[model samples]
Target: MSSRNLPDDKKLIDLQRFQLLVNAITDYAIYMLDTDGRVVSWNAGAQKFKGYTSEEIIGQHFSQFLTPEDQKAGIPALALQTAETEGRYETEGWRVRKDGSYFWANVIIDAIRENGRLLGFAKITRDITDRRKAEEALRLSEQQFRLLVQGVTDYAIYMLDKEGNVSNWNAGAQRIKGYRQEEVVGTHFSRFYTDEDQQDGVPQRALLTARTEGRFEQEGWRVRNDGSKFRAHVVIDPIYNAINEFVGYAKVTRDITEKYKAAIALKQTEQALQQAQKMETIGKLTGGIAHDFNNLLQIISGNLQLLSAEIAGNQRAEKRVTNALAGVRRGAKLASYLLSFGRRQALDPKVVNIGRFVLEMEDMLQRSLGETIEVETILADDLWNTFVDVAQVENALLNLAVNARDAMDSVGKLTIEISNAVLDENYARAHVEVNAGEYVMLAVSDVGSGMPSEVVAQAFEPFFSTKPEGKGTGLGLSMVYGFVKQSGGHANIYSEPGYGTTVKLYFPRSTELENCVVIQTVENIVGGTETILVAEDDEQVRHTAIEMLTALGYKVLHADDAQSALAIIEAGVKIDLLFTDVVMPGPLRSPELARKARELLPDLAVLFTSGYTQNAIVHGGRLDAGVELLGKPYSREALARKIRSVITNSIQR
Candidate 1:
């Protein structure tokens, strides 16, 4: 027979084999339903899957296998209608089994036809409950990740297109980058960088890095919408499709401005604290050296005075003695300067008109500066008077003049101007340790090559100078700084390269117009015959003190430390006064020793001394309330005066 006119034997054999294969499978419910929804045929798969024999299940209604809800909702009939119209209907839902229990099933109904006439439907169903649960879990995980990203406010999480334009924005992006979605979306991300960075093509470079290397990270200054600057940490990551095609980028940014500021402030505070500690250490060292050196000077001056007296009436020897006295005066001046720098020298603040003081120093400055340097003065006629140590001011000016001359190579213009001004609260707030009040401003401007900014910043640091080695001590500006601060004043320097420098010293205005009251020297005082006790650790200082007190008409008792002083006072040998150094090597303190002596003998007078005593025990060379004090290295005259003062004061008590 012709193949087109009759069925081939090969096709007949394939149909039988397909039927046999369908009957052999039992796990899948394979069956058929007629156009009226009746079970017309059932294979072994149907018999095994539904737990029914072909003889009992055939010719039964297909609706019996559907859930009650599916039946009540007409889902099975609707599915059959759809399959009849569209040729197939597929879905997954609850389907009934032989045990009357439901299983999640994937079902498909495919309409069958021959010669364009409806015949039946082929149905296939599968158990897929685990797969449905896995899909649900995956959906929940994606939701959680979205929430996590949205809650982050410190980081700017967003997306950018391949062209580097913002394609997405989150709350974090709006908060950190200071841009609303409407403002930033579709705009290039380069707008977030500073103008300088943008000009330098940093944004394009970042994009290139991300596209070429898959990621880019950087930290630097960024500008906000309001034109403020912040330190930002940024990351850009290139995104790609599943096919490995370049898609876009995801960008994240964070603001680290507050953290940066905190680090800088911590560094500044640490430096300030270190400077304060150094100053305290130097103060103690200065006081010790001054006390020891003063003693040596006293011996020299004293022996010389005696020698001059013993060799009286020799004109040549007298002239030599006069010159020696002048040298001794200069040595004393040097000691005073050291004491001033140490903040130990006594200051006699006097009120003087600022204008007149500048005028008075004009001639001295002109002579000291030489004819090569032009000296000019500007003094306000109605300037206010200021309270300060006149001699120290003169020295400070001289030091500044010498500095200016050196900076100019000995030829420059030195201008000294005095004026009255008021420092308001705003100004005081920016300055360290200064208050809002009236001030007398003394400005010293020099036309010479100026220092660099870095050098100017540290100009007041102790032992820091720019002059050639060995030519400068580096203590001039530091001394000026310390003295001005101790005198309730402020000092600052301003310099610009090639534009010269100006140093402005501000002294608090004085309410008092009277000249300084001179303090009486020990020579003008008298000694007393008080039984006094002295306590000192240094043997030389202790013996020198005892000898001076004895020579000044006082009965003296000596001790090496505070503990021995207490023992002597306890013995009750008519001790009229207790003299002890502040710092001792024993269990007893100077103050404690004084307290004990007063407790035993209520009439006992106390005088404390020390070369390295902290300021806690004394203020501005004045003793604490209800106490008497004599500083170390005292001479016979100083001892006499201190003894008389303490005794008279004790009598008054």
Candidate 2:
């Protein structure tokens, strides 16, 4: 606009004042870019944001304000193109200043069009670095809080809807409330309060108090799902949204019944027995947590494997991702350890030769322990066969070796011994949990620091660790104990303050001979052009399986449970194979679904998979006779091979 074309002097002065007002603004960068994205005009606000004077910045390309990465990616050109074609463009990203420092910024570019002709672009920028950092920290804090709530086992932590109905329940909630998720969710939370409390409308009062004052806490008797009564320490806190409106309530309760009993015992005795009594509290909770944790790890591993194939360049990034994937596998191992601790894991108790198992693990033990630590194995001749889950035993063995290594510190001797023993009636009487039987004993001894009698007594308790926090989850020995007990055996730890520690696990001797090892010929994992039905309760797993199957030239029909799978099968579609999970929510289990499917199509192929065997298609810790099973965390290759193999078996039959 030319000043000579103005109407009058006063109006021109008013226009000058308006221009001065625009230049006076320092909080927001206001500028104009030519048709080609070169700076055509600048204000004082631009100098405040970019630290560049108008004389120095005019005619320079506006891409100079963007970071090198954005410049290299042609972001400035895209912004201009978008603004010119679509009227405006807005986004948030890192912006560089004249001093070369970067600041997180919010930017907007609008096309200055007249008579449908290209004129210039009006641009604005604002610094939001502090706000961005605050948001990131808040996100991380919320994540940590969520994980902690999910991991709580000592208390029932849950959320209630506005009207006091249970909205969400954690493992601890089910453990303490004695109600499965299906029963408690959507039900009024007052069911747990005593009749007197319910009559007094205690639940409503608590929610009201929390909503008004931000929190409410009390100690009273709460009824279990079985109608039993127990004293509970309860706290209710109002949950609020970002706008400060009340959304719900976070309820946490701890059962102090067993703690009251521990009050009569000595301090150390109470501390040790505290968790042991609480074992009943985690009955179904731990198992479900372990299974879900394993499934999560499987998903992570599967995704990482898939990602590895896609990233061809950048060795540094690939190596970092690979290392992270390895850490995830270690986490998976930990989850496996937890599953054994819960005794919910499916077992394949094959008759294993004790001597052979020990000898096979010797090399691994030696490698795991440094050269300073001496590794010795005592293999008894004619060692009895034991019916045990081989994978669990391997996990237990590795755990024991790691513990021994940690105890040994600089240098020590570790001995692994295998022997056959018979527990008489008298011995079984002393150990009430054990039964008199012929047994195969596996003992690990360490010649290093050992626990005192007090510590030894609580060695098998979960989270009972002498190590510093973050160094241990204290589940290793507990896992060994749970596995041994679940396998119809016993675990005993002998330790002294001065001498050392010897941990022994006794498995009932098996009359059956050692299992025969089968070696199958390797073939390419290629899928057929046949239709297959996939039944899985997890949405992500089900979708991933479908995608992989469809990619492999197979037509996939999927459902979230066994009942839906049955419906698909009874629909009369030609299904070449039934791929299903062992665990589902409905009354129809995988075994029943497969049975019905087989009845419908006698030669129909079936393949089952799970993170842990849920005993649906398994009997006595092993897959049912003539059944084909694939363990979870399966890769595309494993899934392909298993499906092809099952289908081939059906054809041969």
Best candidate, lDDT: 2
Clashes of 2: 0
Candidate 1, residue 435: CA error in Å? 10
Return the top candidate by TM-score: 1
**Per-residue lDDT for 537 in model 1?**
76
Model 1 segments more than 4 A misplaced: 1-13, 23-31, 36-111, 125-127, 204-218, 235-249, 300-398, 408-445, 484-492, 503-617, 620-653
Which tens-of-lDDT digit does each residue in 487-559 have in candidate 2? 8898999988768899999999998889975424228978789999999998877777787788779999999
Q: In candidate 1, what are the lDDT values of residues 165-255, reduced to their tens digit? A: 9988888988877888899999999998888999999999999999989789998999888888889889999998889988899998999
Q: State the lDDT at 406 in candidate 2.
A: 83
How high is each candidate's TM-score? 0.67, 0.53
Q: Stretches of candidate 2 above 4 Å error?
A: 1-280, 290-295, 517-531, 550-555, 571-576, 612-615, 618-631, 635-653
Please state every model's RMSD to the true fold in angstroms: 7.4, 36.0
